[model samples]
Target: MAKITLKDLSHSYLKTQSSDADWAVRDVNIDWEDGGAYALLGPSGCGKTTLLNIISGLINPTKGDILFDDKMVSNLNPVERNIAQIFQFPVIYDTMTVYDNLAFPLKNRKIEEDKIKAKVHEIAEMLELSSTLNNRASGLTADGKQKISLGRGLVRSDVNAIMFDEPLTVIDPHLKWILRSKLKELHQKINRTMIYVTHDQTEALTFADQVVVMHEGQIVQTGTPVDLFEKPKHTFVGYFIGSPGMNLLPCEFKGGDVMLNGKKIETHTKVKSNNFSKTEIGVRPEFINFSSEGIPVKVLSVSNTGRHKIVDTQSQSGKIKMIAKTSEDIPSGSAFLSFKKEYTYAYGDDWIIE
Candidate 1:
């Protein structure tokens, strides 16, 4: 295993990049500890794949260096880096049997046949493909074929790190959960450095110890799943990481107090009168509740989702959303809203006010 370090990594596909907009990835510096499970998460064009390819040596960065275990590997090819990569789709030969498919990598290195058999069987069993060892790869389902592709990566003991790029996209919804669980289990048993790239928040949160959230060619935040949900450092993070997301209400900072809709409200962070273009208060829907007296709001809509209901309300300042238990009574026409003081945060210029 190797500790991967990205030093001021930036990549631009254009030959003459005139501005930051042309860059695919910019000014990214992060250290992935050895044996750590990490995920690169964001929307479709957020440079997650570009960064992954750079780490795999599939593409070299336009700026900065990549180091593995303290050795500069910016100039090395994928083979020299000794890393295994699984793509979005299965990359396996249809003619080969499941056993041979898993053993191919070991056999390529001229490992002894007995050792290759043992390793192949071990990985096959772990992926729950031991029973289909003799079956041709052409006959397996999509998930099964993908498992074979993953098994090839695991069968090799010499890999320094394993990287997955949206490996579960083609999987069925029910099997996606199963495969994710299996991947987590494999990571625990092997303890190899693994980097997963995906647009799915669930995949990133559940499989990774740390999730690197990227946006518009830049990394916005990197944190545990809990940190991302509880204390979002950026406005985009607050808007992106949740089911109903966070409710951002425009406010003003005056005399050491937060004024929303010309009324004072409490928040955990004190927003000073700074020269910011935007000022707002952020509170998760989970943290907002109905109160007998607070900010008066007009109930717009309520969506029942089994155990809980998402209530949408419009205040004088802006619209807000709150999550409430299904058992609780949701006021019909008019209601008041209260934000838990500890969970409320102040924002300036689209960033948390610290």
Candidate 2:
């Protein structure tokens, strides 16, 4: 295993880059510790795949260096970097049997036949493909074929790191969860450095020890799943990481207080300065409650999502959403909304105020 590092990384596909908008990835610096499970997460076109390809040596950055275990590898090809990359679709040989597909890498390196058999069988068993070892790769289901692709990477012992680029994109919805669980289990069992790239929050949160959230070619935050949900450092992080996301309300900073719709509100952090072009207060729907005496709102609608109710209300300042228990009573017509101060935060220019 190796600790991967990207130093001041920036990439632009254009021959003559004119501005930040021309860059696919920008000023990215990250150290993925040995044996760490990480996910590069964001919406589509957020540079997740570009960064992954750079790490795996598929693309050399236009302006920076990549290192493996502190050794510069910016110019190395994918094979020279000793990394395994599983793409969005399965890349196995269709004519090969399942067993042969898993053993192909080992055979290419001329590993002993007995050792190859042992390793292939081991990975096949872990991926629950042991029963289909003799079947032709073309005959398996999409999920099964993807598992074979995964096993081919895991079967190789010399890989410094394993990178997955939306490996579950072609998988069925129900099987996606099962494959995610399998991947997590494999990571723990093998203890190899793994980088997963995906836009799906559930996949990133469930599979990664650290989620690197990217937005517009820059990393916005890197944190544990709980940290990203509870203390988002950017408004985009707040708006992207959660179901229903966070409610950002336009507000003003007054004399040592935050005022929303002319009502003083408490927040988790104090605004250090009021020099921002835009200012807002961010609080998740899960942290807001209907109170008897707070910011008054006109109840707009309520949606029952089986386990909980999503209440939408229009405060004087803006729309606010709150998650309520199914048993909780939601007032009709009008109600007052209260934000949990410990969970409420102040933001300036889209970044959290320290």
Alpha-carbon runs more than 4 Å astray in model 1: none
Give lDDT tens digits, candidate 2, residues 1-354: 789989999999999988889999999999999999999999999999999999988888899999898999998898789889899998889889999999998888889999999999888888999999999999999999999888888988879999999999999999999899989998999999999999999999999999999999999999999999999999999999998999999999987689997889999977778888999999999999988899999999999999899999998888999999999999999899999999999999999987
The pairs that clash in candidate 2 are none
- Candidate 1, residue 352: Cα displacement in angstroms equals 1.3
lDDT of 1 by residue, 214-287 (tens): 98888888999999999988888888899988899889888778888888889887776677789889999999
Deviation of model 2 at 244, angstroms? 0.8
Full-model lDDT for every candidate: 0.91, 0.93
Model 1 RMSD vs true structure: 1.7
* TM-scores for candidates 1 onward, in order: 0.94, 0.96
Error of 2 at 231 (Å): 0.6
Q: Which 10-residue window of candidate 1 scores lowest in summed lDDT? A: 268-277
